[model samples]
Target: MLKFLKQVTDYTKGAVDAARFIGQGLSVTFDHMQRRPVTVQYPYEKLIPSERYRGRIHFEFDKCISCEVCVRVCPINLPVVDWEFNKEAKKKKLKHYSIDFGVCIFCGNCVEYCPTNCLSMTEEYELAAYDRHELNYDNVALGRLPYKVTQDPMVTPLRELAYLPKGVMNPHDLPEGARRAGKLPEEILDEMKETQDGESEAASANAK
Candidate 1:
């Protein structure tokens, strides 16, 4: 009789504990039901992205010196740069600049390594496409800044030099000169001389 009474007391305690837990859970559910829904309507309502949000990549062509630092730093080697030295003009010009966005991880390494600050990320993250081939972007496509991105204060400063003029002559694209001269071009030599002269004058001024 004593053992049966002890078992009945333990069973009664277990039932009470189970009921308390169920009541607590129901109370939480009821409290949550009283709150407003946080769901947003897609395609019509859009949320503004934060400043640091990394999205599509933008390229500033005029600012790009073709240093290839972006290409070197890219984790997936998505940026393809084809450039050659123009012996006559004494400048490097890009033959081709393309990015395979399909393979791009958007790791921001390219933007980070760009010495001229020519690369940046935009807030346009809707990158879905029907065909994979359409995802590949060349220099011209990458150079075009998004409409929303143009309004950004941070990017507005670089608007002028961001896109190069269409007819601008690329030094590398010029026809090869008749003479294959091993020495640097006269224009380059003159510029170097002028720079040196300026530096020397500054040094003398400082000394005085």
Candidate 2:
């Protein structure tokens, strides 16, 4: 009788523990059901990149003086600055400037160190091609305007979490001009300057 009672108790305890485990899993599922999915459908939907995003390189043929500053600064010595000295003008004339995107790493060093600000980083990152040779962009190709995601009617541009307002888990269907949660870097700097000014004024008053 004692042995039968012990076996029954053990079985009941095991069943209760199994039920608890199942309940816990179901609770987790229910909790997540209320939360929105944080995935992008990609190609159809795209996240708007930040203002300072560095993607592809843009070059201005007219602005570039064939200084070869880009080549000198580049870690790979990537930029091909073809120039010829014009005896009449007595200056270097840019002939053919080309950058191989396949071999070139988008470090933004060329853009940063350019004397004439001819080079700039664009948000156009779609450089996929079957042939690697097609990746090489001449001055004309580099001067082409970059396609923006927000401007594209086919793509649904969604803000990233960092760009979104506070407590906004879902970036979709957000209101236009919705300010981000925290103060901007500029705003923070302005506030700090104001506080320092106030402190200085207080110190002068105390000195008086």
Evaluated with lDDT, which candidate comes out highest?
2
Put down candidate 1 lDDT per residue, 90-197, tens digits, no spaces: 999877788878999988999987889988998777788999988898889888875464354543211111121333322122233322223346878998999999
Predicted candidate 2 versus true structure: per-residue lDDT over 56-115, tens digit per residue: 899899998998989999999999999999999999999999999999989899999999
The CA-based lDDT of model 2 is what?
A: 0.92
Tell me model 1's lDDT, rounded to 2 decimals: 0.72
- In model 2, residue pairs whose N, Cα or C atoms come closer than 3 Å (at least 3 residues apart or on different chains), thus clashing, are none
Off by over 4 Å in 2: 1-36, 192-208
Model 1: which residue pairs collide?
A: none
Candidate 2 global TM-score = 0.78
lDDT of 1 at 14: 99
The superposed Cα distance between candidate 1 and the true structure at residue 183, in angstroms, equals: 58
